[model samples]
Target: MIGQTFNQNRPLSQSLDTQGLKTKTRSFWVPLSIFFVITALSITVLGPQTQSIFDTREHIVQLQQDNRVLVDKKNKLTSIDKSLLTRQARIAVSAIPVESSGLAALATVRNKAFSSNITINQLRVSEGESSEKDAAKEVRLQFEISGSLSDLLKFIDSLSKAAPLLRIASVKMVGDGVTISTDLEMKTFWAELPVSLPPLNTPLNQVNKKDQDLLGQMNNLKAESLGFVAPASASARENPFAPY
Candidate 1:
């Protein structure tokens, strides 16, 4: 009877121990699973917002850098002499005019020919060809002139240094010992200025040594007319369409 009572008590104790272990395991696993679920939810909800905040910070830094560059450019521009800039602008425009018409080029040619003692018998102006849309537009000028061989040679040489830049495309000459008749085809170029400026954030490039040298070379170009013209010699035109 005593042995059976001891055996029954041992089995009851073992059953209690198993129940306690199960309760402890349930408590541990329940909290662990809940922690994992909360972590997943937090990543899903806050990941995009965190990334957006980081991107915004990077953009702000980039804008700050751009602003600094623009301010530097503005300061440089403000410090420059306005008169000097104006003079340079004039020089540049005279070198390559804005009008596609060959009026400036024609004037230069006439002035040079007169100075060289060459007589222009015939002159014609026409448009030139361009391969690119935004390329410089060209104006073609054809000339028939007669002069002494020496004078004709001097006129051609002077054309190289004249402003409203001219390029002699083809030249043909027939001489009779004392006088020479020449046929000349020349080209002049013009381009339109951009109507709009770049964005405010764009960095302005300072004129470097190469650009300064180019400007100096253009400054050396011979202007078409340096002497004064008498304004009183002007004649009024009533009808340009009327035939002579």
Candidate 2:
């Protein structure tokens, strides 16, 4: 009887052991399945979203750089425009008139000669032919003036400060003892009537160093008083429909 009871207890113990193993296995499988599902969701849903966020950030940075470059360019253009409106710029522009004639240049030379106490014996005017290189028409003045050497030198110096800039093409001088007779061939320039100004956005042409130096020299000279007359205003009847 004792032996049979021992055998019965052994079977019960074996059954309990089997049930404990099943419970442990079920707990392990449940946690493992949850971990796999979370990993899959992260790969499928979150991966592309992260990449898109990075791409958007890069685009924003590029746009910021472009905006900065545009701002700098705008500032530079504003500074240049301000410089264009200065007094020196206006004087430089006025040095070359839009339209002029030989008569005005001749008057300037005569005035300078009178100032220097020189006598102009003859005055001849001729028109220069225009070419592709020099689009503006040139006026050539051939004249003879009589004065002392000192007076002649003064007259030439004064010409440089006169308006409607003149170029001494040739000069011949003869002296007897004190008084000298000088023949001069000079040229001045003029644009045709109805001149149009360049557009504001136009780029400036390249200027040579020599030309820049000459302009600087001209700026140092005293301003000549050229009595300019304003053109008469058109009558309202002339263009009744035009804006005031």
Candidate 3:
């Protein structure tokens, strides 16, 4: 029975083989069509949009450059702040004496001026004579400094940035180089000044100064801020006695 079945299917196989070639078709057309469609959509939609962005290439480059410059400036400013904070930490800020006026900050300035290879021959200072009764009062001062040109410029620049607000009103330069002389009149400010102490009926310093409250406060301020350590909180450190 198996031999007869094999013999019968032989002709059928031969016939199918001859007809199969006629029905055979390639399968690449569907994928090829999809590829064309995708390419067309990208060129018509996404391609033009991307090309527009390229048109602004010059502007984008300039903006990037500007941003980099600004970042550099920011870094420089940050470095300056850190340097100032470090210096302030090393040297405590003392309250200037209210009476002598400009004695504290001015001394610091004058010392710096002298050390900066500058010779200061003449120095003058005048504390303001405003009444302690005045609400808006400042302990004004006048200074005339003679020094080398470079050293004087550096001194002026430092004082401007330093705390307590040292200001220069006038500067006169006489010569150049090693023989240079710069005369500067400078001023520092104090918001309130203490009143001049008067003759007391009782022993001195016993009675409270009711009238010259600002003056007394100014004296205390000078004492406290004159190279005194800031409180722990101001120092950005934890106070040991602070409540837990």
Candidate 4:
């Protein structure tokens, strides 16, 4: 009887020990699993959100920098005198027109020759060649003229100060030194205005000293233009005899 009692107590004690171990394991594993799940959620969900916030902040900083630059440009632009700017703009346009200005160039030559007392014998106009691509288109003018050598020299010198920017390509003089017949090959330039504009965000650069001097030179050039008188409009009478 004693041995049986001892065996029964031993089995009960063993069962109790196993139950205690299982309870401890469940308590440790529950908290560990919860921690692992929370860690995975943070990596999968919160990580991208944090990165996006940082990227947006960097973009905002870039935008602010661009805004400051634009503001500075605006200030500079506003400080310029409007009338002086307008005059410079006109001078530049008159110097290099946006279209083929062969007629205007011819008029300038005719006026200058008349003023210099040089008689033009023959005049020819043709297209000119450009050395660089996308450069100004040139109009070549061939002129045959007769005048006193002093007058011819005066005319040639005056051409440099004329508008449309004439370049003397060649000159040949014949006859006595007092009265000279000359062949003049001259070139004038024009270019089509830009059709495309830069983006609004592009940085603007003010005209530099070199460009200002160039503009001043252009302003000194004289342009001759032909004038036309407007015709009077005729009124119609109810009867043809009303005119009499």
Q: Rate the local accuracy (lDDT) of all candidates.
A: 0.87, 0.76, 0.58, 0.89
Top lDDT prediction, candidate number: 4
The C-alpha TM-scores of every prediction are 0.75, 0.52, 0.35, 0.74
lDDT of 1 at 244: 72
Pairs of residues clashing in candidate 1: none
lDDT of 3 by residue, 84-141 (tens): 5444332322233223446665555655666576666666667655466543334444
Whichever of 2 and 3 has more lDDT, that candidate is 2
Show model 3 residue runs off by greater than 4 Å. Answer: 1-101, 129-136, 193-244
Q: In model 2, what lDDT does residue 7 have? A: 91
RMSD, one per candidate, in order: 6.6, 14.6, 25.4, 7.2
lDDT of 2: 0.76
Error of 1 at 163 (Å): 2.4
lDDT of 2 by residue, 1-244 (tens): 9999999899899999999999878978978899888888779878888888899999999877777766665566666646533654545444554565577677788878889999999999998877865466788899999999999999998887766667799999999969999999988777643457454334444345886676676565443455566989887587778877
Model 1, span 38-141: residue lDDT tens: 88877987787888889999999998899899889899889888898789888888888787748878888889999899999999999998889888899999
- Indicate the residue-level lDDT of 23 in model 3: 56
lDDT of 4 at 37: 92
The ten-residue window of minimal lDDT in model 2 covers 198-207
Among all windows of 10 consecutive residues in model 3, the one with the lowest summed lDDT is 199-208
